[model samples]
Target: MFDVPLMNRYGLLAAAMSVLLCATAGPARGEEISLQKAVEIAVQNNVELNAFRKEEGLREAAKTKAGLLPNPTLELSLESGALTGNSGENAFSVGVSQEFLLAGKREKRLALAQKELEVYRWQLADRERLLRLDAKARFYQVLLAVRKLKLAEGGIELNRHLYQVAKERLAAGDIPELELNLVQVELARSEGAKTAALEAVLSSRAELSLLLGGSEVDPALPTGPLEAGGAVKEAQGDLFRLALERRPDLKALRAEAEKGSAELSLAQAEGVPNLTAGLGLKRDTTTVEVAGLEGKDTSYTVGITLSMPIPLFDKNQSGVREASVRRDTAGSRLAVAVKRVEREVATAYASLSNAEQLLSLYLRNVMPQLEENLKLTSEAYQLGEVPVLTVFEEQKKYLEVNQGYLEALNQRQQALFKLEAAAATELTGGVH
Candidate 1:
């Protein structure tokens, strides 16, 4: 019989071991990394970004080849035949030939290749920007995990003190054994929560280390305290306009559209005929023996050859249609990209506004009231005016609210990051 619980237990154990291995494999040395350093490391080691850089180099090489003139061809021939009755003749010829692209064909090809190179170059830039955003997101995740672990540890310490006070009261018969049992159970729960939090921190650290392309990581990340006091002013419309102009992905799409236009031009140019011209020098030597008379003659000939393709069967008409279709597709894709960026920016702005409001409410109203309630409940329990259960409930409420507030703060910070990423702007409100 299949056993689901057994499988789940094994899966959990495997996951725990994986986390432990990642945590213990390599230790970070030197000072902790700032956000800038983290972003730099991700850019240098990210596999996708490096692949794009290599692709850009290949496109550049292709562009160079496209701009070069075609190589000339060499022709050689030898012949032996009868020049007269019972006489033999030999001829040898050599010529050099070159084909010239007609009607600015080479120029059009070069232009198309240049546009394609620009597209790849901008694509690489776009990949770098996305990689930086990924790194920043992972960095903040680790920071959040670390913060949560600290909160859990603080809760454990507070619970330990309360357990000790409960033990003293139970020894003096001021509190019943049931109250002491409740404190003990709460301490145990706190310990479990702390353990879970620590596991989360380690997991986040390992993820970040992998993103940095190395195993060594400092789990103790520094996060600046939240600053919510600044006035909440709406971002300018011009800022979003600048982001539309400067965002690398949008630029890459624009370049792609231009390359498609060039492709269309090249396809149209294919209808023009190319010319192949050659200059040739030939030598003919003949010996004639007519019943006792012999003569030798040699002659040189210069000739010009012109070759052009006939537009009878195929004049690349299909290529023109294909190119036109591709251009239209590129145009459509570009429009869709523009719309997506606009929606992304709007969504991020809305999230930031909501997060700011939530953080403010938690900081100014919710947390302070929870703290006061906890204090009052503690005093009442000491004076026997309230049951010990009331005090315990108040403390639990206080801890829950504290955790909620921390979550709200982290959410706001993440929202700010989203806004920056969407707008392609720095935190300083300038275009990145």
Candidate 2:
């Protein structure tokens, strides 16, 4: 008994050690992720996407089941009664029956099921596209927040230096105390803005983490700057064509139309009569005295029976009509889907072109000039050729321009994401 207890204790210790080892090894396996990795994680772990995947699995199973034949049925019967005031008679019967669907009923059902599966397939694809777009948007927002925070920090630094200069000038009787106090006030405000910008960066990072399936991410994550390389030259027609051909929503609508056609076929098939055939055997016995033979027994041979429903009152004409109406409705909906996708593509293309132009203007003309002017103003202040206030105002202008440039870049990235989403293409060369 002591040996058994000792073995149990050692086994427990070994199991505990194994668990500890696994725990220690887990984090090492955690991936050093990029934007594509984050998007993949979101696609895999998002609850809505997972639910849709499960629904697709169920639809596939339904499709498989729909292709199978109907189940055969078994039947039995027994009877007993007194006859001829002498004795009792008994009868027993057993039968097996199966209904054969007419007019391609099984094939129609299978086709409908297959069309439904396609709908769900396209639904999953659409979800993937939307989720990736969302991830890209959030990723760019985080980058923008970081850029703004950096700009705010630079402003704070410049303001602090100006505050110190103002204090020295006041002490040496070169500037009024009120001027120094005003600089100190501006420095404090700059510090506050910097703190707010830092908080915004952290918040944006947290939001990105949630989008990446609740995985923690570094607030200082690096992102590639937006570049305008693939802007559509002839936007309207090409975008419309791409949207009509590749958009998942349009695909889903087309699938619905196919399903509706299948349903109509199935309803028409239902109007045809289905045949049920059965084979049975029966035995009968009777006891009588006055008849030609007393206690007679009889056996009936097995025979086949066929059945079909009469088409007097209802031949499923109404069902076929309803299915026809539904098919028409589905066709109309698909048309609407095509038109909607075309409009969306046109809108996205227009916005993308506008954002690209604005971004180019900021990059080429405004930001470079602002940087040079800020430098000149700083130098002029150092040489006492301009007042300190001029230097401060020019510094503010530089920071503002830089912030605006970052915003324009972010807007361009977002527009690109939307355009790709509309076109159902990968803009980043990989999914994001």
Candidate 3:
């Protein structure tokens, strides 16, 4: 049965609660920066990426230079000088010559330039991926610091309470003054821990700020479980093959080898020699009789000349040899990169697996036991059956376990990040 009056009351209560939450959450949400926002800021303002952009512009200019035609050489001369005492016999000449490329040098250079550009494109993407990984790692560090500070503050409060209880108990002769003094000393220690944790939080924030272009981040931490990240995918077959296809550094090396091949070919092409041809105008003056008429005559003569250097002494064998050796070196380096990627993938997988198991054990077994023990010990202390110091001792153990759990989770995340770097792929979209 639908109760109209009860339904109305429940609807009003839900609406009021929604309004209250919004009212309280508005300012905090405004000041808080999300992980996605942090990544965006870092990527957009990254110094290395900006420098790469400038270098890209320079490479494009080089491509343009590679495609340009050779400029012509201009020439001028005086055939007869006045010192010969033949003023009217003076002859002047003007000529232009151009050397035309005989082999596929320009095309090969352009192709190599394009490949180099492709390499830079992929390198830029790889760089961004690394930058985003760094930002996410620092974000996680900040969250860890925030959690530690909370633990320290709580420890201080609990120890201060114990100190108070000890004072009362000592006044009534229920316990010795030594216990009270010990409790006081413990409270001081907690305060020291709290101070160190606070300093750590500040230092973490400063580091993150540097990554984020010096913008100060709010203290309100990211709102999510640290373990909430992408799972490691199953590697079915040929992960190395995938790395070869995707790894940008490897691609850059391959591009260098291709460029070296082109360079070697260019050196051989230079050995083929370019044809240089010249066209010129020569002035000639003579007095002669053409058939039956005699008159003073002026004439212009057209002259053509062709020349090229013989490939006898320097046939570019040294240049070709140098380029071939460099190409071989690039290939060897690529092989080394392949070996490195394979090892990194295997090692990272092992670390991630170990971290996963330890985290599971802590959550499923150790954490609960520690929590139960701490709760019971605290209750016992309140009932005067146990010393307050005993409760603190249990808490100290609990704190260590929690800290270890956080560290394990951190290691798991690090391993995943390393896998991403090695594979040139994202394990997580990185929002976590």
* Cα lDDT, model 2, residue 111: 92
Cα lDDT, all candidates:
0.72, 0.73, 0.71
Candidate 1 wrongly placed segments (more than 4 Å): 1-31, 82-87, 219-223, 226-236
User: By summed lDDT, which 10 consecutive residues of candidate 2 come out lowest?
Assistant: 20-29
lDDT of 1 by residue, 105-149 (tens): 889999999988888877777777777777877876776666666
The CA lDDT at 254 in model 1 is: 88
lDDT of 3 by residue, 1-432 (tens): 122343443343344334322322221232377777887888888676777777998779888988987899999987654576554455778999988788887887787678768778767877877787798788777766766766666666666655655665676667778888888888898889889988987998888877876564555444444563766775813545566677777777787778778777777887787789999998865456678986656678889999998989988889889888988897898788778878877786777778888888987999778767866675565446887668768868866776677677767777777666667666554321
**Can you rank all candidates by lDDT, best first?**
2, 1, 3
Clashes of 1: 0
Q: What lDDT is obtained when candidate 2 is compared to the true structure?
A: 0.73
Error (Å) of candidate 2 at residue 284 is: 0.5
Indicate whether candidate 1 or candidate 3 has the larger lDDT. Answer: 1
lDDT of 2 at 403: 70
TM-score, structure 2 vs. true: 0.86
Off by over 4 Å in 3: 1-31, 216-223, 236-241, 286-297, 429-432
Each candidate structure's TM-score, on Cα atoms with residue i matched to residue i, is: 0.87, 0.86, 0.85
Off by over 4 Å in 2: 1-33, 82-86, 216-222, 226-236, 290-294, 383-385, 428-432
Look at candidate 3 and give me any clashing residue pairs: none
